[model samples]
Target chain A: MTIDLFQKTGAFAENKDVARDIRVRDIIPALERHEEVILDFAGVGAATQSFVHALISDLFRQYGNGVLDRVAFRSCSEAVKQIIRIVVDYMQEGMGIDTEDAPEA
Target chain B: MKIHLPNSAFLGNLDSFLRGFDSTHPDHLEITANDQWIAVHPVVLSMIAALGLTVKPGNVRCGPLQARSGHYVVRMGLLKILNIPSSITMVEHEPAGRFIPLTQIRTSSELTSFITEMIPLLHVESEQAKTIGYIVSELVRNVIEHADAEHGAFLCAQYYKKSHSIRIGIADTGVGIKATINKSHEAATDLEAIRLALWPGVTGMTRRDGGTAQNAGAGLFFIKSIASVNRDFFVIYSGSGFYKLLKPSPTRRLRLNADPFGDRHSKRDDLPFWHGTAAGVDITLDQTKEFAVLLEAIGTTYRTALRERKNARYRPPRFL
Candidate 1:
């Protein structure tokens, strides 16, 4: 199956609030149509940790593990990406599983 | 004009006490030795409620009083829960110095300059003076970037010659730190966000254009480091929890103390976060040099940002 990828840059690209909402809107639809989706956050600066948590953890819960089988993010700033990784670890820990054991997407 | 309000239940009595004041007779208004502004949480609520009872119910102007131990305790406690900077903090020696309240970003520069000008008043050195500039600017600039509006934030500072420290505060009417975190992160609870944000390398910056993190997860890191090394003071109040880096208990306040620069040294984080969020900082630096005066220059940078017009727009840009 063909998975659609979406890229955003400029204004909203840098908005933590909007980027979060966009992540939800963009990802959920692709879940229904395709088996995987990759979000590119290149050229984006800083994002509030909350925004990353929403995209990485909250969205996963909304869809369920099996529902969002293949998910990936590309080209986020190191700071932005680090927060995402940390938040994901936090969520995984909350679920009582090693993050490495969890499926990506 | 002394009144005792042990609880909010006494708001009516407090109201009567306030009503007793007449500007024409200022001497009669002086607080007596027994007069204590008991800022109990519930009592403060009641005070606000009582004040709300007024017919016109407009602007309420209160104190620019000398920084007292009590004021430090209550304010720090409150700001901690709210998760914003407390515009006022402990000064080492100066007493009864003038306080200027500047709310708009346009005047941030003047505010910084004003502090820089006050450096000689306290007798700090050039290097320490630069630190004063950096800390104050970082604190104030963050206010402008995040908590200024959604929270109706306001900024004010106090310079005390006797104590040899300057105290400043920035408050807002937006969501508290807890709310901001909750809104920003679906996984993080308000409380968790509070804890995490304080951790070094944890930042609120986003990947949007306006998303630049004013603080690089490093601002607080550096500030805390400086406070520790120099024996300065630092406190952060976000959402409903208070996190402090000071005196014995580094993570949280086991008990509250009010010596802005007490021997034990205490920093309070009672920034009001009733709005979506509000954040403020209260820092006290040794004022033996010109650093504080130079610190004022940072405000000018913030003021310049205000003039850019880009900041006026409420909504973040939509990248279609």
Candidate 2:
């Protein structure tokens, strides 16, 4: 399953409600069905840490650190990529994942 | 209540103006200004607007301005927003690339729309617009989600052509930081609450390392780090406590601190009581660091802070 992020959050994805909607309404359901979920950030310019956290942090908590393997972030700008890396790294760190397993920032 | 607008009150000298606020009477607001010339930060106006909403329109009393620059506040929409009668009449200039008049955002959708229309007000470059938009979105969302304010958040901004800086201010008359933060952690004073709130991974919602799914407890820390990297000023006032991040000396090398007090800052615990919270930040376009670089610094610092917090609580086998 693929989610067109720009269609949902515009160019700059700062709205947490929209991010939550994408996560609850789409991302979680796809992951539960054992399908890969691709978050397409093709036209997205910038995103807040809160928005990114809302979109994916709970999935890590619910499914553990392995969820990253089933999900893909597509066409992310450098800034958006950095933000996702930040949220993912800290979340894994909070869950006591070893430094070797956490994604690099 | 009485508030005296001094001749000058930017983030640097905003302490005096905050100290001079008389919040004794909860029902009436009396505003007086310097007679010679008046120049103040938008936070000053935001604080007043937030307070004015609490009292009846007839209860707000504004003394006539004798200063030449009193008309400036009129253009900023303070008098009109408060519904206080004013004799000063000035031509309303087009607000494009100048200033954002006083605005009250009460809902999440309102904030999203406000940012879409707000980016063009400063005529900034792409990088600068991202910083401004990010700050506005984070701060306003905090209010809507946690402030419990009936009238919501009041915010405004001004573009300084001379210094190429954008000054933004947001104010809310809610239950204040102490009430919100006390739900999860104990903060003995308002300044302590402010400190805890600014620290990464600390939220009123949970005491867990990373915040809940919806919140990471990082909004204020990121905003402060932006100002810190740029060597700009960021101030937060709630209750009688105020915290201001001072500009570092030009010769000092930049570093992000996990603890707000570890950075160069001034805090007060004895100022006049403000019922809610108000925050103001100054972003200089020329001095702005790249947003990506700033985020990297923030990420590193936040991770280290989280590690140290867990390690502190970790129990090791008895090493005799």
Candidate 3:
């Protein structure tokens, strides 16, 4: 599988599908390479909570435990981080992951 | 147009209100959840259902609706149905310290236009007006689901010119903050209850047979977090009277680290929960434009909730 990650800077992604595509097309292939996957969203602008949820939820589900732990997010704004935090919590609770075992923002 | 939840003890009152077969149409019928009272106008309910995906000829189908007095939760399951927004608006008003209420049903269609229209009333750019739209959307969405008002819903947007702060109050007469907390745990005083309701996961409704944990709790928690730490203050009234829970004092406002979500310290004090179902929220914003963003986010969230509820009802759980 080929790996290609595109970083876009804007206030918000138009919808969740665009967000999910970015992950499925770009991030997943990169994960196929090594046992670990680290995604760096360092310079992207404001992203919605739902968009982030669509992108990462499947990964979290597939990985079972520590799925997101292998994928890292760096240098996101407080707003972006908050969205990630909410989505992660939703996924964690939905998947029945132990809150203690879940990674923090 | 007004509906009252006469008997807080019975669910039949609410069922009647939802059906729109109100023998007492045009008059207010009070609806109560966990003792919280919300007076929903028949027209408003009709409009909301008509505008959303739950447009069944004579019945109402909402996503997940859990009501206790202070904390009420309704997930909008129709989001996926509504087309993406072509426009948005945000508003900051301090016209008076009193309540100023606006409805999402009216503004959902012309969000961009509404933002532009508010420009003259607010004398701000369309962008800032859009932010007000977001804030209002989130606040109102919270109100519709959580704020229990039997009659008139109170809303206010106060602009403190001196400090460059805008505080918006969305209140209802149903149940106060304290009563919401009592549903989860017993509390001696209103203050303790108000504070406990502010905590995460303190919902009056527990999990139902087909509902998800998303239905467990967390609406007010997000609303308060967005308003209190990020914006300004989030105040509530319940079994007791009105009270304000602000993070940094006015004197030390800027010196305080901007934490949209309150610090753990605020939870240190054991606040009591009030009995009854109604509750309200006050949110502040530094920039008006963020309001529109918030509003769209809220719309999408509720729409999803509505869909989820409809799905659950149709696909009942089947045990082996």
Candidate 4:
């Protein structure tokens, strides 16, 4: 499942409400079906840390380190990629998991 | 009683002006100002008018204060914006002070509009404008999500052309930091509450009202990181606790009885207490400071810290 984040939430995804909508409507359902979800960040100007955290922190906590395998983030700008990395590392630390061996998105 | 306008109408003097209102006898109060060399920002004037509505309502009147050339036009514009009837008749003109009036952020659309309108007035380039817009938006969102302010949030911004810096202030009359953070953690003092709040991933909204995922708690962390990196001024005041970062070294935490702007470099904690939370950001308008570069640097720092921690956790036991 390829989820174009820009198409889903417009170019700038910073609001938590938009993140909640994306998670409930797209990401969670894809994971439930065991589908490999790809978050496409093409044309996205920026994704705030709060938005990324809201979108995927729960998923990471629920599935633990295994989430990296099922979820792939592509076409991310350096800014967006850094934001995702921060969220991933933050959630990983909270769950007492190490990111040294986690698969790259 | 008649009150005279200060030569410079800046926000720093707001509290002093408010103190002049007589609560005992709201009526029979008058405001007068000699327009000669009087310089007032629009934000300050609008805020004063708003305060009038709250403090004395129709009991106050403005007496004739001679307005020099351009001052008359600006004064009329301010009165029009405040929707206050004025005896002075002048053509509508742009006020000297560039400001966004006090607005409520009830929806995301309103927030977006506010950001769009405010960024241009900051008088910075495209990238710098976007960065400041994001910071302002994030801070206001914090007010809506965390502060729980019944009256919502009030924001005011002013760009000091002479100083080459822009100062933004967001205030809320809400549950405050001590009360909110105490919900999720044991914050014994207001200072502790503020400290914990600034830490990444420490949020009072762990269990959201709608059972949604908790807030990332990185809002203030990001704000502080950017401010410190740029050597700008950032201050957060909640409850009785006041925390200020003046860039470089020396961040102070104090308690204030009122909302007087403390010395940016003061390193004390014995002031009075403010009722709610107020966040202020003062950043130099440097074109070279890009938001993406700042975020990348912050990410690298976080990664390095996490890597070190993980390495320590997994290292073999030390030799005897």
Every model: iRMSD: 15.3, 0.8, 9.0, 4.2
TM-score, per-candidate, Cα-based: 0.39, 0.98, 0.41, 0.74
Residue-level lDDT of model 4, residues B159-257, one tens digit each, is: 667877666667665778888888877888776787777765567766321122748666786777777667776677666566776555435432211
lDDT of 3 at B136: 47
Instruction: Determine which window of 10 residues in candidate 1 chain B has minimal summed lDDT.
Output: B25-34
Against the true two-chain complex, what DockQ does each candidate achieve? 0.02, 0.83, 0.14, 0.45
Q: Order of all candidates by DockQ, from best down to worst?
A: 2, 4, 3, 1
Error of 1 at B191 (Å): 3.7
DockQ of 1: 0.02
**Could you tell me the TM-score of candidate 2?**
0.98
Candidate 4 accuracy as lDDT = 0.63
**lDDT tens digits, residue span B1-320, model 1:** 22222322121122333333232321222221113434222223222222222212223323332334345332323333322234455553432234332333324444345444544443555454445544554444455455534323344444445655554444443444554444344425444555544433344654121222123232344344445444444545444444444534345443222111322432223322223222323334552223322212222222233223233435787999
Q: Model 2: runs farther than 4 Å from truth?
A: A100-105
Task: For candidate 2, write residues B1-320 as lDDT tens digits.
Answer: 99998899999999989988999988999999999999999999999999999999999999988899999888888999999778987788899998998999999999999998888767888888888999999999999999999999999999999998989999999989988999899999999999999998889999988889898889999999889988899999999999999999889898888899999999999999999999999998899878888788888888888888788899989988
lDDT of each: 0.39, 0.91, 0.40, 0.63
Q: How well is candidate 4 docked (DockQ)?
A: 0.45
Candidate order, TM-score descending: 2, 4, 3, 1
> In model 4, what are the clashing residue pairs, if there are any?
B254-B269, B255-B271, B256-B271, B256-B272, B256-B273, B257-B272, B257-B273
